[model samples]
Target: MLFLQNKKFSFSILFLLLLLTFQPLSSSQQLKKNVEFNTSKKDHCQKQISASLLFDITLHGFLLWASMGFLMPVGILVIRMSNREQCGRRLKFYFYIHTILQILSVLLVTAGAVMSIKKFNNAFNNNHQRIGIGLYGMIWLQALIGIVRPKRGSRTRSLWFFIHWMLGTAVSLLGVFNVYSGLFAYHEKTSRRIRIWTIIFTVEISLISFFYLFQDKLEYIQKQGVILGSDLVTSTDQGLSPNDKQKELPTDPC
Candidate 1:
């Protein structure tokens, strides 16, 4: 009887041990499946979020690049080329075009900036953001300066002109750099291809730069060959000795 009771108790304990071990195995398997399912769902949601982010980034990039890269430079170029036009109406037309384009560019930049703030909810978090903010400020300031241009011969006109020119040039250069930074950021965030865009942008910049240099050098070269003949000779003669004046007579007009 004692042996039978001991055997019964050992069997009961063994059964409980088996139950506990086997139950946990099953529960652990179910838990693992649940976790995997949850992980998969999370991954799917993340993918959706990434897609939306990429779209926003691309849109922002387009707006920024269009404003800074294309519109601003082209507007400035139009103004510069128009200055050489002798027709007042034509010059005015180009000036109006430049103003319109610049305004459009500013609008685009403002849109981009609003979008950024809406999406990111933070500013100056990075170099790109800081530079972009500065660029926008400078661009608006430049536009204001242009609008309030001083009279041509005012005492402050020269200072204003220099300030405007320097500020504009700095903004343009900084804007180009910011565009590149934006491209880099876009690629880093989206892992998208940037080589084609980079190449195209580089080519565009090269063409613009070439045209600007050509215009500048062409003007300089033309001026170099200009013979202001009689007027220049007479101007020089006023400072010369009589013998020097006589010697210059053949080259001068009476």
Candidate 2:
């Protein structure tokens, strides 16, 4: 069931991308004429602000949140797979999805960032441009890490892994803040659906992240013959099981 759901989501995102890409292109001529008509010396700055506002509110806000919603869980899965003691069909599936999702996420972010930068390069003191470059670099570095994560048991690999996690987390949190600021900048003036959907997507991604944080703990408790019900909780004073004792796990993802 989870597999099916993920497949459906992947298709939906692809469809959405296609629609958004083509629809805008189809109307570009009309949009260009409209912009020219609205162009005047007195209103030049206003036009830039309006363009920036539209890109930030529409593309950076909702689309960014939604992309994170779909990508973060897959990313967590990729890391989990790298740490797993045994590989199986599920791990392979996760690898495939993770790679594909990472690429798609980069593409989506690139499109949005390009639109924002082109629309408001000078008006915003290049804040948007800087973010665009930073985000691009982070995403590419993450992709490179994913490609090499299987061999990351080495010292260099471990170093890259740490860097990857730090930068990835920074980018994700920055994206969240950027979206929030965009929303606040247009509060009560933007579409109600955009606000509501962004909130819903954020909450959903956060919950998934929380669950990912407990993956190791859950595995340890299960290996110790404890059921994964509400009854299980970690105790600092208690000794870990032999299975868990051999494994030095890091802190939770959350």
Candidate 3:
């Protein structure tokens, strides 16, 4: 009977050891489950982050496009066409509209620049990023130029006009080109289609270019009209840029 009791005790000890060993197995299984759950959560968060990045990139492109591409060019168009208006409130009104449009453009571009700084890494390694940096400096320079503008008949007015027109033209062209590069970058990053957007933008730029050049050549197209380029240049207090209005004909002196 004593031997039987000893055997029972030994069996009990063995059972206890078995229980301890299986406890670790259960814990290890639970740990594996936890690890899988965490991994899935991490994957979900990464997807959300990627989606957010794409949206922000798209917004950046849009802001730049509106400011530099659309608004700036339209402003130039407004002022250019307004040179045809007789001196008075009509010209002043056009000027006001142009001023308003340009102000809005600057505001939009500033917002875009801020977004790029905050959201993007800004390595500036690519043409798009490099162009963007140039655009920022040029924009501020243009603003300074606008502020320190000379009086209408001042000697520096012509020089100022030249710089303003040339720089404005350059900004518009570069901005448009940068947007195209941006679209390319977006496609490379996201592997998404941008063909529709590219086509639409191309159409928009073509239309604006057509009107800009057509108006410029309208004087020459008017049935073999005689033009006196240099003599008619100083007709207004504000010197017309030879580049902008070289085709203006002389006023009939009766």
The best candidate by TM-score is 3
Residue-level lDDT of model 3, residues 1-254, one tens digit each, is 99999999999999999999999999999999999999999999999999999999999999998998899989988999788787899899888998888889989999999999999888888999999999988987887788787978899999999999889888998999999999999999899999999999999999999999998888677634444443464466257676556567565789
Measure candidate 2: CA RMSD. Answer: 27.3
Q: What would the per-residue lDDT of candidate 2 be over residues 1-254, giving only the tens digit for each residue?
A: 99999999999999999999999897997898777877764498887877767666566555555555467556655757556646778767776776777778877776766765665444544444455466667777777776767473576876876787787788776665555555554555454445675677678767877777777677687766754332354553155776686576666788
lDDT of 1: 0.87
- Clash count (model 2, backbone only): 0
Query: What lDDT does model 3 reach?
Result: 0.89
Which ranges in model 2 have alpha carbons more than 4 Å from their true place?
1-57, 125-133, 145-155, 188-195, 224-254
Clashing pairs in 3: none
lDDT order of candidates, top first: 3, 1, 2
Give the Å shift of residue 54 in candidate 2: 4.0
Model 3 TM-score? Answer: 0.84
Cα displacement (angstroms), candidate 2, residue 69, comes to: 4.3
lDDT of each: 0.87, 0.66, 0.89
The runs of at least 3 residues in candidate 1 whose Cα sits more than 4 Å from the true structure, single-residue gaps closed, are: 1-34, 121-125, 151-155, 219-254
Error of 3 at 112 (Å): 0.7
TM-score of every prediction relative to native: 0.71, 0.56, 0.84
Order of all candidates by TM-score, from best down to worst?
3, 1, 2
lDDT of 2: 0.66
